[model samples]
Target chain A: MKFKAFLTENGVILLEKRFLPALDKMGKICHLFLTREHAFFLHNLLSGDGVQSIAQFHKEALFDDYRISSQNEDRIAFAIDISLLNRAVRSSVSICSELGGGGSTANRLQIKLVKKLPPNSTLPTPFLTFETKGYKSAVIQDVPISKPLSRTQVLELQTALDMAQDLPQTLVQVPDLNQLQNFVDRMKHVGDLLNVSISKYGDLHVQTSTTLITLGAEFRKLLVIGEQAFAPPEDQTFSAQTRSERAILRGDAQSVQVNVKHFSKSLQCHLAKPDCAFYGIAPQGACLTVIFQFFIPGTRQTDKSISLHCRLPVLDPS
Target chain B: MSSSAVDAEAPDLVCQLDNVQGMVDALSSVRWKRNQDAVIELSEHGIVFIVEETGCLQAKVYLQRELFTQYEFRAHGRPRFGVSLGLFVDCLNSFSVPGHSSFIEIRYPGPDMKLLLKSVDSLDSCIYAEVRTRIPDSISWDYNFEPAGSTPLTFTVKSAALKEAVDDLEWPGSNIQIKLQPAPPAVTFRGEGHGDLQIDLMYYVNTDLLVAFHCDRQVSYRYKYKFLRATTSNIPNSVIKDNRGSKLSIGRGGMLKVQHLVSVARSSTPHPHIDSAGYQQSSRIAYIEFFVKPEEDEDAVND
Candidate 1:
């Protein structure tokens, strides 16, 4: 696969010309120059497909807002469009790696602009789309999900969307209350393994306390159960036994009733695939793990043993 | 077991048997006499009599008061069986309170035997009033015994005055029975001067809250009972000959004293099975002193 990197007004614009290793072996090359006029031509040429063309698709123009100058030597145009670049391919491309990065190691530069190419156009000769064509995939529909998106692609796509923007938008759309409620309910069913093992994707908006998660679905599929997990020995005084602890997702079954025992407790969430919203990593997973540091009241310590368990459905479609 | 033989010479002995028979017969009849005497005086008010006759027909009467404390009883008798006595004291117009009377009902197993005493309003019927105006000090008694040939003999009796209050009974004037029910133990006399006296008797009664038994032991000493603190002091018996190992020695100060016997002492004061925080309070305050067999070495006074 071929990538073009060049300096522009804003800083640098790196374009992934071809994304398949096999296509790179076949000598596929991308030749879009880093220039504004070339970006405009590319935008107009493929503007009429089901694909979204973001480079010259002016939002500010319709909103009567000022236009900013393109940062790169060329308006770095990009698209999920494999058809248009068919003419550029020398041979069929086979896809391998799963992650996408800003720039290669030799070229440690940040991308400052982005555009989408139109769909269904033939691959330009000397450039090729990977025949295997598998990256992270997501399914979107008009219905507001009552549950979180349990799949990995939801987070992957949301993160990619942020990185795809020339400037990350400070205001992101949050999932509705019904969606969060459903997600929370569904979270009770996922097993402990899935609850702590899966990855999560989150987005932060400028003006809200709610962290909008794009792929909180995996967490929604898990439930947290059991009493607070870390307690001192039975002989320790409540004051002497003071320590922060988290709840275990698997122990006893989760009861529907709110336990008076669990009042005044909180946990820090660490989702595997973090975005601006929940961008901490202690454990990696499509799952979410949290460390609940609770200042439990002294009267509650006892010889009593508590266990909790949660049921997790396998989200793998296979 | 058979009442066939008797000393024919002593007619008084025959009469004594007759009086005993009368008393037993009267008891079987369940006859209780109300105020039948107005001025008759007595000491050592002996009530419950237990009779066991074999070698010596022993008749033990539990006395509430001492031998010198006077009481007004309406009965006259020459006791028949061997007499073993108990005593109790009932005070009239105590502390000069017009209606406040204190009565001590005692049983005599020992001088330390705690009697059951109850105090109520002067208007309450169950309290028997002791008329202190008529008889203040104690009285002496002389005993005469009599035996009957076969049938029990009845003797005509007389006393100075009929006691106005019987058993210290009180009642609303409306319920007061003027006539004696079952014609109380006949106050009969052959003499003309012995007549029933009519007086505005304030009270007449008999009752108990808790029963007590007689106890007699070597620890015959003065005890001051209190609702709060009880005090005890012993008067030295200089005359008591020291019988080596026969009896224990008294404490120093010949007059050994026990003070600060509080009814509601601080829970910290020693007692068996009392937890510091778990002590319970009693409704009424009472202090009592009694000589119990010394359980601990320290409990006994060291001479």
Candidate 2:
């Protein structure tokens, strides 16, 4: 197996400084899947509990000279501590930036897989080494990673990732994350689980209840993605047949109950500076999916280079 | 009364406050421990929350009728109920968004005797909460603090300075000694543990720091540092922001009473009537009082 890549300046700033730090807060370890087309950070994919997060980045988005060759269809997957990787990247970026000064993009950051003996150990260990070349000197950071998965194990992971990508039938955009975070923080004190309901008519209702009290918040008039937003005007009069048909068109609201902690952890994605977020729930689904959409800076177009989303495991209603 | 007649009558108590943050601050001042039960009594004048710690420490938070934009009480008599202080405060805090001043409507006897709270100011979203309340038990201890003498030995200091001084004295100390003397007109707080630390607030030293000093004789008393710390530990930021002063007075038998006033007026938009009214009634304020019994061994004396 062989993997080597040079990170672009924008990639270093976003991936190392923003994306990885945000993902680090969500989980301890994540699988770094490398392929010719893209790189994916998969969290909690093999675990049965906790939130599952998938952050995808196209090869060109983060790397200029990317090359990877492996036995199993040129694909490689391994688990590594997110914080350790983040720290290595941060140190490399800071050292390079310091040596190159602010304006000069002369510093080059290269990452490659290497097997070397770690200090205080005789046996060789696999590490993802970050080599930052400056004008005068170079700094290398070694981040330990798990042994690569076998071809069968890689196939199993690919299957899990494919299954986890099942999108909900309807998706509705949520309000500002800061506002939602403030509201969810308060709900956390009320109950352990949160009931999230998304309607086709563009309404999101979040409710938390205990035997003593019930607290709920409703955000209405939200834009429904891929569907026309609708609200019956007060002055309009609808016939019985039309009203029933309209109701059918609106569809039923999908409801899911999820752990409050898992939901809150997903909201930390705001650090990635996504332009907008969409929330959806499948009909009688066991999970709630949140999609973070980023737009290209200084333009209205969506950034196709990166795609990030998470699935929060739902609790048994019974 | 028939069930229909009871249903026809308005809720036992319904009140609306333009800014719920004030109520949240006042209640949080007395919430020192988790899952602490607070007894709430509603009268025509307003609402009073009473929380007691064992039989030694008692705190009361008074929210007057004027504090609310609308206060309606149709019950035959004052109603009292007990609820978790932490839960109630947290629920109120949820209704308050950081930048937006949301009006909250509160109603009692909601369906199954739950306290209903709903935010009415947001057009995009509405937050509603129901908190369960239980029958209030008889108060364990109620001390009618009689003046120590003809003139009560009281001193008022800036809330911010007082909080700082009290917080600073939290070293290795079990008891704090408070001494007040009229000769130099000063109040001294001394905490002795690993070493001795004394903080003096003299009337003539910095009049701004010591807002008021009314002591006719020298009085000395000792109080548990923990109980004393509780009085200033949670003085809300609103109180300090207003530059209000906290009044500490010594009653008979060395009973200490500390009072703090928290302004509940809406900061976002001032009502027209607020300007017409005089300074005192212009803005509504919540009153918080804490009563602490001095240590038994230390005989408080008039020197």
Candidate 3:
């Protein structure tokens, strides 16, 4: 829907579009300017009347009020709202230039605005002189000019008018396919770990709101610097500080075998299931140890061993 | 814009066939509206019709099991006059925020009578649905206000188009059946192996008809959600029933537990008769496997 532009008795022009109707009949027919907002205001003023009363004037003058050429004989011009046009205007002011020429006759219209001289102020009155060189310039005179309106100012003014409104509540950044797949995998694991079924699960997910703040110095050392920068020279006790003190407890490649210990024990016992009994005794209490270890893949790393200590009662050989 | 210009700007019907294919191609890749309660809309006759949003797991199953059935059918026949409905449904179902409905509208002209393609397989049907469903999109956050520990957060949730469909469903063929398999991970280490993991997927598809013989009649079904959970920890002291890995299913309700698989260690007790070595040998490695049994066996029926 296009906005209606109207000139008020105060000579200020407003560009707006609203669903108001009866503002026309209440005042003198010759001088009254009707807009959807004015119609809405009248609807409010009349306690019992519904939108129907205002709709009557909308049928007669709403279109005429919206037309750029249509003007009421009275000096009052009612502005109907056009948000798109307003947006274009607000955006246009930023890149607008005084340089105009070398275009078709249709592109030769120019608007001249003269800044009002402030009281007792010696600051020269600024005149925005629009001239189209090599072509006859259409001159519009006596336009009350202030500083070109900023987008913020225009938006503020536009918002001040009563209208149906909705605010943007969500903005989602689209993730690449690989990222989405990874996220889906992570979400599924989370769901599985939590013992919850994620049926009807959507491929789309809200990006993780979690953020990590690391010190500049630490981040660079931990993430950017390579292992060659801290390679130990084979002789002395090699030690290096990581981004966090916890890294000290969890030793890296160079410190892998520093305080490590290992034990290999053998025991002879009886075997209850003698199906393949070739290892000698009647295996009763067989001692067995399974070792679990963790290690980084490359760069001369050693496995960290954690033994599951187990003790078995031996036969009374008395 | 002039009429011809508007028509030029007007979305091309044939090109959208490719778009529909593109949507189907990257079905799982696109994020659906997160919440189970969200509605998806389809534009027909300039009016919006909303379909229901299924929760996470249910949505995956719906896409994998149900969508493939339609995708296969549409690919073979009815390429031009394809339903192309699941794109709208899948998009709404997959990407919306949890507890929120994603309002999406897929616009199309009513039937193009001038370019009607003769149906070789069977009679084409027009299905019109006027459905209204509510989807929850608001998540309540509870926490104590401590300036030191406080994290400032800004949250936005759009109200799902309450008046329109949250999901769209269509049958592109006479018979429909869909099966899904987890896509293999891009990178796998040569020697190292990882334990059991879950992967979620989706399919955006349309079918000409579901249950071919019943195309003459309307087969209506409501989409819902259910969650499943299970415990994979090999520790014995951990809570057996509750701590076991679980699955959360979302559909008609908000979040639900679909399944639970507890580690075998939790179930087995140490027996004096059996030594540690013996018990370790007998320890049944715990891992979850899935299987589905069809109700009506066509082979059996034929036999």
Per-residue C-alpha lDDT of model 2 across residues A1-318, encoded as one tens digit per residue: 999998888888888867998899789999999988999999998886899999999999898899999989999999999999988888887898689646455678899998999889998998999998788888888999999988998998899899888888778888899888888988888788787877777777788878877787877778887544465663024322233235445555667789988888899888888899999875467689999999999987899999899999989743
Predicted structure 1, TM vs. truth: 0.13
Q: What tens digits encode model 1's per-residue C-alpha lDDT throughout A1-318?
A: 122332221211111231222122212221222222222112111222111111221222111112224333213323222223332221111111232322333222212222223257563222211222223532111111112122342334334333322221111122232333232333222111111121111221110001111111211112222211222233122110011101113321111111111110101011111111111112111111122111122553421111111111122222
Best by DockQ: 2
**Chain B structural similarity (TM-score) per candidate:** 0.17, 0.92, 0.17
DockQ category of candidate 1: incorrect
Name the 10 consecutive residues with the lowest summed lDDT in model 3 chain A: A194-203
Structure candidate 2, residue pairs in collision: none
Residue A112, candidate 1: how far off, in angstroms?
16
Give the range where candidate 1 chain A is weakest over 10 consecutive residues by summed lDDT.
A263-272
Candidate 3 lands at a TM-score of: 0.17
Report the Cα lDDT for residue B109, model 3.
23
- Please write out the lDDT profile of model 1 over residues B132-207, one tens digit for every residue: 1222122122112321122222211110111112112221111111111111222111111133323321111211
Candidate number that wins on DockQ, 1 or 2:
2
Question: What is the Cα-based lDDT of residue A111 in candidate 2?
Answer: 93
Give the DockQ (2 decimals) of all models. 0.00, 0.41, 0.02
Q: What is the TM-score of chain A in candidate 1?
A: 0.17
Q: Which of candidates 1 and 3 is the stronger one according to DockQ?
A: 3
Worst 10 residues of 1 chain B by lDDT: B227-236
